[model samples]
Target: MFTDPIADYLTRIRNASRAGHRVVEVPASNLKKEITKILFDQGYILSYKFEDDQAQGSIKIALKYDKMTKEPVIRKIQRISKPGLRKYSGSEELPRVLNGLGIAIVSTSHGVMTSKQAKKEKVGGEVLCYVY
Candidate 1:
């Protein structure tokens, strides 16, 4: 059993990307599904699919890479709010990742969304992670 599934999810993707894997699979949960959607919508990932099985489902994510450089599009992905120490920010205080070049995923009351979206929606909640 994993104590911090979100962290594990991030690590799996990070490792896969560093290893030049075309796709990475992660154990799924509602929060993870929402995060995956946010990543896809932001164009960080090439594509994603959710598979439901008898036990917990899993997510298959096609990571993005630069056409010419052959470098992974996602240079970094870091967890913010962790199980040990939680991180929260208001819409007004939301962080601007890489000066708006990157995205910060937040879990607001409205739903799990990018920090920019949360700012536009005028709500705040736990800050999940930073992805670029």
Candidate 2:
């Protein structure tokens, strides 16, 4: 039911999931739709596996309207580490570092993403496919 490149990406994710590989979820909002669109335009789709067949693996992402909320809630499917970077000493400093690099932390239907990526593509709402 997926179209071309999107289907391909979904298949890849599904296969990886079946093999027990971990995947990252990036969330986003309207401002980040550009990024999600980019992924779609490039034929990329996100998918995930579930414990039950009936369960929709798709996620629902919403825009952050409250300025009070600073960080997007991210679900860690795999251990994420910066290449060649040591563990951060302070939890408070993490956002400063990520933001310094122009990454926008967002909660998406698929997961979380940097503002840069979200602005580049169009991704939001409920997931239509499980990555794998």
Candidate 3:
């Protein structure tokens, strides 16, 4: 049993990208699925698929890479809020990752969305993670 499934999800993608894996799989949940969608929408990942079975579903993510350099598109992905220490931020106080080059995923009352979207929507919630 994992204490933090979100952290585990981020770690799996990080490890797979570092290892140069084309496709990475993660055990999925509603939150994870939403996060995956956000990643796809932001172009951090190439593509993703959600597989539902009798038990907990799984997510298959195709990681993106630079064509010429053959480097992963996601330079860094770090979890912000944790099971132990929850980090919440208001729309006005949301972080600007990499001077707006990167994205901070937030779990807002509306739903999981990018910091920019949250700011535009005038909502606030837990700071999920940073991805660039």
Candidate models: Cα lDDT each: 0.95, 0.33, 0.96
Clashes of each: 0, 38, 0
The best candidate by lDDT is 3
Clashes of 3: 0
TM-score of each: 0.98, 0.20, 0.98
Tens-place lDDT digits, model 1, residues 9-117 = 9999999999999999999999999999999999999999999973988999999999999999999999999999999999899999999999999998899999999
- Tens-digit lDDT track for model 2 on 1-132? 433433343344344434444453333233334434433332333422222233433322221112365322221112123223323212222232233432324344545454334345554322222110
lDDT of 3 by residue, 1-132 (tens): 999999999999999999999999999899999999999999999999999873988999999999999999999999999989999999899999999999999999899999999999999999999999
State how far residue 68 of model 3 sits from its true place (Å).
0.4
TM match of model 2 to true structure:
0.20
Worst 10 residues of 2 by lDDT: 71-80
Off by over 4 Å in 1: none
lDDT (0-100) at residue 39 of candidate 1?
Answer: 91
